[model samples]
Target: MRFIKFFFIVLGFSFLQSCSNPSLYQSKHYVFGTIVDISIYGEDEKKAEKVTKAVLEEFTRLHNSLHAWEKSDLTDLNESISKNKPYKNASSELIEIIKNARELERASNHLFNPAIGELINYWGFHQNEFNSMHPNQLKIKNLVARGPSLDQLHISGSTIKSTNPHVKIDLGGYAKGYALDQASKIIHEHHIKNALINIGGNIMAIGQHGNKPWRVGIQDPRGAQAIAKVDLLDGWAIGTSGDYQRYFINDGKRYCHLIHPFTGYPVQGVYSATVLIEPSQNAGTLSDVLSKPLFISKKEDRKDIAKKLRIYHYLIIEDKHISMTKAMADKIQFLNPNTQKNNQIEITL
Candidate 1:
């Protein structure tokens, strides 16, 4: 469920003049098994470091709690649920994440499932080894036949239990967005004016960089070029999910890490999907989770699903075509004009 981190391009910023800009402080930290880069503008160096340090500490706390496979609080909770044992005193963070997961699971008709940990393991995605090796048909069939759903989990107050024995929850999909939201809160509490927090590829921009919108680039799924660029004003969050990030080619076929819960395999039909929305809407989780709807939801139902999920704008790239919401079409500038295929479809709903 790991998303490919998209690269952000700052249009008006220059790297050579960064040192002369004392109001800007930037640093990169290793958290959540990825490099998180944070930049703060309009703040003194000392104050920026203080704000960054506080956010980093928060990230450390969340990294230990929401990890999918690692031995952490979440793993402990998952182990308990797998054995039909309920954890009476789960953390509030875990409870909140699970509550959101359940809501999204129902909204997408189970297309977005956190209880597909077993299925993820079957495909060897639980480990870091994402190679040409795939699970056997029998294993896939068995898991698909008895796959678990987030609805099967029971959450009452602080207590949590799993009614299905095979249910194992993983929050890797929305974990980064959740982290960003928490970090944004900490940043705002510090009164930081302009800041950009990029966890892996998920980005949330607060305020503006020198009276200008924060510029971001969406990576081309088929190559290294940036296919689209966007300007993010205040309180904007954007993320991209691509099949190119974690994948393997076997017998001339490529397999990605994003598994479709219904089919128990990597989802096709989309090479990359980028979503933009207000972080305040859902604490930045919508940008992360909603980016994959083009691949997860049916074509006819995508607009309705996007509306239900509160996605403000989106751009989806396929093998030989592209599709975008009307909002995205107005905002996105295709860096490589040739990449905008002739069969482009506009979603207006």
Candidate 2:
């Protein structure tokens, strides 16, 4: 006999049902300021629960280690660079994250820098309080002066040193994707053939649903409704970054959470960016890190960069216009554009 249940809870809800003989499908959410929704497709409920717990635990561990606002975390490492002291042998996990971040910085021509933590704080995006005050010109100049390039980081095995004492590292751009990658590995090792992991805005899909691709909806930046839907077959990952997720309004102007490291101001022109990639141990970390830079780049320059990196399947929504890369346009199939009354333009990637 197959058993399934669906229940709605105020804080978190679960939807579970059995389709194939023994295989079950379940979706649930975990809340921590933001909610992480996870969907599992498998036969063993006990095993699925265990895998889910492991994935969540890994997320918690990474959050505690990398969150800059947490005073108890190793944030002191960001300030001790002037002493010529290397960060005390960091965990192998953190070391790998740092290495990947540095590589991304180089790949994006310093557009995707991890050494912008101090700048992030100065802009007040890290604070939960929504304030629309922009930093002054002098403050912006000082912060930019203190910024460190990826080359300034020296790493040997698990040890890391910073050439600039003012350089502080923030993993907000890539940590969730890295965590999802690690969690997916854990699930696969447990022999779970199908699963979906969503950490905040980062999403990963493995296997299929009843021989059909898992369906993911890309939310509209202007509202809560989904504007586009993409199918994930044989496992893929998708990530979306937008100004709509977090913002504050002041004097009739809205300030978004994503700040431009160069100007110490919020990034403009583009409203949202969504990236799709094959999910592996790294999932879509590279894509997530590159999205912001791609969003702010000129149309021609963005196309050139995407082609150089061999990223053809991505979407950018800017100035209320939608554009898709030729590579991405050929693969993505849109389901519902008129689902809601909101205005959304869809383009083939």
Candidate 3:
């Protein structure tokens, strides 16, 4: 309903569902600040519908509790932090999520920091509806100078306190993937196979669609169609971070939500980033969280960061052209043989 994030189109699933088979069921909901799509294949309608409902319930719970600016546990924590008080009201679930987000933030050298949410709000992103407004340059600089790093937060059991008063937590980067993991858990517990859970553009696939791997189209950031398609295998996930999600044009500059902690400004140069993560305990989380750093990093440093993060399959869309790991190029089938034909294609090992 708000911003158009990095969304994907499921290619052949519609045809499979339209065959009048009770084995296919799908549903969509507006949650987690974006659209959520759930599809289950080869399950009876009753079972699929039940499981899908459970998943949506799980998403709604997460959305209500984790929302950064709303009256949520996160907001409560931020409020306490602002007043220099230790917050103990957070749920154990939220604590764990915060712990994981902190570790991920540290892993990215704080490039994926959620602690700069004060700066995020200063840019007017906390609103339910966004308008084209430029933030005050002096305020942006001050927030950047304050440097509220997630590492500054001390979490002892249920209590979370921040050393920097400016440290406000926004788990927007990680919540969807956490919800995906929870949905996967629900699907597994219910013994439902062959399901796809997509929150915004972060997607996870179960078993398969009948006998074939589920194919998902990575949406082109600048256009209406998918630039390429990939077979989303079981236990794997894919996600993209694009400037198109949230931002306004000012003086011909696109100021997006993916801000730089050190600069206190939206990142430029890159348009979008896509990452494909293998099955793991936190595959969904990694898929959701890792794309931001890639989108924020300098073009030449892509390989280094990918190596440090151990991300094998990656793709980046820049203003001029696109770049990707050869592993990613190998997995993706470009919709047009000459995608972005006007620009250069850079592939790395």
lDDT of 2 at 222: 63
Q: In order, what lDDT does every prediction score?
A: 0.79, 0.67, 0.86
Question: Once model 3 is optimally superposed onto the true structure by TM-score, how far is the C-alpha of residue 198 displaced, in angstroms?
Answer: 1.0
Per-residue alpha-carbon lDDT of candidate 3 for residues 1-349, written as tens digits (9 for 90 to 100): 2354546878874534645756668788899778888988887788888888888888888888999998887898899999999998668988888888888888887889989888889877887787667678897888899989878888887788888888988888888888888888999999987998888889999999888898899998888888899999999999989888888777777788888888888887887899999998789989999998898877777788889888899999876688999999899988887685866889999
Give one digit per residue, the lDDT tens place, for model 2 in 44-122.
7787788888877877777777776676244766756657688777778777777778877776667677788777877
| Sort order, TM-score high to low | 3, 1, 2
Worst 10 residues of 3 by lDDT: 13-22
Give model 2 RMSD, 1 decimal. 6.3
RMSD of 3: 1.7
TM-score of each: 0.93, 0.85, 0.96
Instruction: Compare the candidates by TM-score and give the number of the best one.
Output: 3
Residue 175, model 1: Cα distance from true site in angstroms: 0.7
Q: Write the per-residue lDDT of candidate 1 for residues 200-280, one digit (tens) a residue.
A: 888999998776777878887877767777888788888877788777666767677788887788887678888888648
Q: At residue 155, what lDDT does model 3 achieve?
A: 84
Q: Give the clashing residue pairs of candidate 2, or none.
A: 313-328, 325-349, 328-349, 329-348, 329-349
